[model samples]
Target: MGQGQQEKVATSLAGTVGEEISASLAPVDAELAARYPGDPGTRQPVHTVYVPGDLLTADTVRSWGDQALAALDEHAPDAASLAAVLGLSDDLAGPVHDRVRAKLRQEPVEDLRVDFEDGYGHRADAEEDHAAARAARLVARAYADGTAPPYTGIRMKCMEAAVRDRGIRTLDVFLTGLMEAGGLPGGLVLTLPKVTYPEQVTAMVRLLDAFERAHGLAPGRIGFEIQIETSQAILAADGTATVARMIQAAEGRATGLHYGTFDYSACLGVSAAHQASDHPAADHAKAVMQVAAAGTGVRVSDGSTNVLPVGPTAQVHAAWRLHYGLTRRALARAYYQGWDMHPGHLPTRYAAVFAFYREGLAAAAARLARYAERATGDVMDEPATAKALSGYLLRGLDCGALDLAEVTGLTGLDRAGLEAFATPRRGDLTASAG
Candidate 1:
């Protein structure tokens, strides 16, 4: 064959391969599409709160769900009572079952997260002693008995050296227990802590893979989240290589990378006696995580503010909550899902979430709309692409989403180029706006 003909044949083969790959990836694209189905203009934030049982009294724990109910009354009244879900410890259940029952009687959150750290902590033998199993059963029974809190599942110890040392075997044992005891709650979320490298996340994934094989569970049945706590994970030891490896490792199964501000500061030699969240080091650490997670579909969530100053007067409490809301929104705008440690933090959670969506939707929609019209075209109108890209810079700046330094980093179009892009053409570019 002539060289030209040979090139043609090679092109044909490459095209065929591309088609096959696209066909295979169709389902995956469909899943991602469905996963984030809202219009960019109306995207609601996914606010997943963490409730620690130790934070509340048993009487308070049982009576605890009222705040969630009140929240539902405000924003998503018909959306279901998800905020009230308990993170029941084995100890909490004995004291607060009835109080929890009263709330469950109203409407149960979709899933209840049982804190393994509270009960099991570093005890590898807790799995054998059946405390973990019993907790699962009690939660299951609560659901079965109509006093149940929707879905019941366990949150294993992610930070404890026991699981880290056992590696995948720890998860193996937990999965075994869940299976032998019938099944898990609605879902399993492995809360990873002190994650300094991507290898830690990869290890978790391998364990999930092994668990699937051992228990006959389908692939991708398990989901995990990394607590972006350690200084190494946030600020790389070897320039950007560590952060790159971290993002690469966290790509698939990671739903979101959560900020462990407390632990992160602690790891940085911040005194445990010091208030971790308020520390400047903590702010810088979270910002690092935020920047790392930018444009990555993996959602970023800020850690709890942790100042539960519920006081004497309603006026004083309201003022405190208002400040909390403003702070929460600021954090959310910085690209984070707000973490509600206390039920009282519900006000802040809703406020921040609403503000994020309200602002994010409008900003994304405006920028995307401009880009869609100007820069992103099929043919010779590539100059329009420059305009659209410039719009992103303006939108990011206007919305407080990105500062000038970050904007320059994102676009790489220097001041001169940006100025040229911003200047309008004489006639042809001017279009009618209805």
Candidate 2:
């Protein structure tokens, strides 16, 4: 092998990467890279507050969810003051408290998961099912009373070989109790945690379909969420991504794929003390999850921050700080939703969420508006940019962090479009006719 300078052949080199490159991306492909929650699933909540089934009651919304509203109310002197407190931009001049009150009253727990798994723990089967039934009754009452959150559901234990039947039974009994008592809420979802195989998701879909058929519920009434906790769920022994397989197996009933930070980290042998949202392994898994769910009508949610906001007695600042940091991490990963174990996490959740949207509002809105008008600009905007832009705004609005007025100027979407942003593929911010 003679080492000599070869005659000058055209040498390839990396080109400049910036807003221009990113702008040209299609919404779907761009979402894969940016992790924006697309227009597939229901509007993601600011957070999913999971309460143990036993604690739920027909009137428990005030007790359980009010604490979160209180958390906001306490810090929020008014909309402007609260915005300043949260470091939100000046554009948020309206009354944030009114939004907080509406959220508290209407859908404080935009997505409420009655946990029979980790949050509830392995208790007596009878006791667990009874609690589940009770939770269903509460949901029914809430629905009848017009107090139901926009999205609500239960988190069953893992569908492992050891307890598959039990998980299925609990889910069935809960649904049975719910339907017989009053009726199912409009946004009923079931979360199957620690899923290790696609077969598990398929099994759940079958179970849900049967329930819908039997109870006169719509065919796809029982949307599902999978916990990507196990290593196998992310990658198979054959080195293939199983997350996609799981979604495919859901057969159109799949809605959410939630990451389990602590469980996943623990499985990888990380000490309990060290496991957190930003762990490299967790990041890689969530990235894989985001890519798998992109454009498939499936939403991705990050895991919870085990660090509760607490001090000697009801500490707020420390909890807020921790929640803000954890939430910021999740947002950076483009996870618009995650689990909330406590009420104190609410304030920080909104603060961080609002900040995230505000920080990018100017740029994103401008790009989106230009894309909608001419479909070309200083930054290339594809159809994908439309979805991405609309999704971003919808997530913010759905969570009460950004109002329509705050977004309209930048997005060039009217009130109708803003209202429809939360609906599935409705109110598409990009208009060809425009």
Candidate 3:
């Protein structure tokens, strides 16, 4: 063919074959789009603070912040002290300590859940109803007065036959209270605990659907986290992955899958001392949950540690070390969120998170910068790698570990540009560089 001429091409099949193929795959295309809508591109909380429903006051957030600061003051007063406890190097100790302190002061708890489940235990109907309504009123007022955490809600009882009706009633009372207090806050979150079957998830959907209709809210406005506590929630009797089906059964209302470390481990017959977030069973369940939720607009949260950083300074330091190490491990495994049970856990939570992002910030920024500029380096990165790199920085920024100016200066890409790469669509993946 000449330079200015086009080459002729021959086809083996009829022209209508192309249309026939498209028609045949149309349903599949729709299914893919519907099932895998991708991440919602929102800020996922790094930790969820669970307080018993009756114990949650308007001052709970501030109280946690104060207690965390006090713990730091008494146990790890300086950077060197904290560094010694958590085994941080000289470079990270100072910055991590400063940021953790600031985070405690500014936003102690990113997400707060008033627990009506195991944390609250089973209570009488009247008492539980009052607590649920009280939670809503307090949460609403906190949000109104700008004192609430970024996210707040209640974790109602499970859908087990024993507590199903009570759980529904609590949710109803809570939502009704919120509706009466005004509308639901944008940060409102709900957790349906101890979900063992997909049918329970579907039932939750039906209940939320009814609530939305009764309140005249938009369809699917409310979404809840599924608490995977039972062995059946992870593996069905038929040996199938039940968590995946739970996500499907949610019908687009499953916001997250939270691993219930203690409940799940107990159900698997793991002894009390062996029931930890880093245990093999917990890892297996969370791994299944992570794979099931990937690209499905749902987040996965690890469970909590019962070890509180209390007692003497040595004991406190030991607990802090344990918590810090587990948090770092979880972060490396892509579990960005977990449960924080005690106020003393706050300092270590932020420390582990801040250190994780800060330690990798420069490398991630450089790689992303190179990718954005289409430059070659020792490590050649593709679109997916770029996505991961940008995602790392974005998560850092979201959690206050990295600042916008620092990221922009290092990568030469603003927040919008980074977000574009961080959440690219299916088509964008192919022509991302272009």
**RMSD in order of candidates:** 14.3, 10.4, 1.8
Clashing pairs in 3: none
Candidate 3 or 2, higher lDDT: 3
In terms of lDDT, the poorest run of 10 residues in model 2 is 424-433
Query: What is the descending lDDT order?
Result: 3, 2, 1
What is the lDDT for 27 in model 2?
72
Candidate with top TM-score is 3
| lDDT string, candidate 2, 81-200, tens digits | 555555555654354445555656565566788888878877788898788778878787777777777777899877888777878888988889887986766678888999999998
Candidate 3 C-alpha lDDT tens digits along 1-434: 77989888998999899999999999998998999998899999999999999999889999999999999999999999999999998999999999999999999999999999888998999999999999999999999999999999999998889999999999999999999999999999999998888999999999999999998999999999999999999999999999999999999999999999999999999999899999999999999999999989999999899999999999999999999999999999999999999999999999999999999999999999998999989998888888899999999999999999999999999999999998887876767555
For model 2, the superposed segments whose C-alpha errors exceed 4 Å read 1-38, 69-106, 216-218, 312-315, 375-377, 409-411, 415-434
- What TM-score would each prediction reach against the true structure? 0.56, 0.80, 0.97
Give the distance in Å from residue 282's predicted Cα in candidate 3 to where it truly belongs.
0.9
Count clashes in each candidate, considering only residues at least 3 apart in sequence or on different chains: 4, 2, 0
Which residue pairs in model 1 clash with each other?
Answer: 142-148, 143-148, 375-384, 375-385
lDDT of 2 at 141: 77
Give the per-residue lDDT digits (tens) of candidate 1, residues 1-434.
Answer: 77666443334366689889999999987764444322122121333444432321222323435764454344333212222222223433322333323333353233344454433354546443355445545544554456543333444556346565543344455566667767654444556666777887787787778777877877868767677767787767666635446655754566567777677777788777674455788677666666665444455666666566354434335543554554544454554344445555544344333333333443443443344445443343344444544544553343333355644554454545454564435222445321
> Which 10 successive residues of model 1 have the least lDDT summed?
37-46
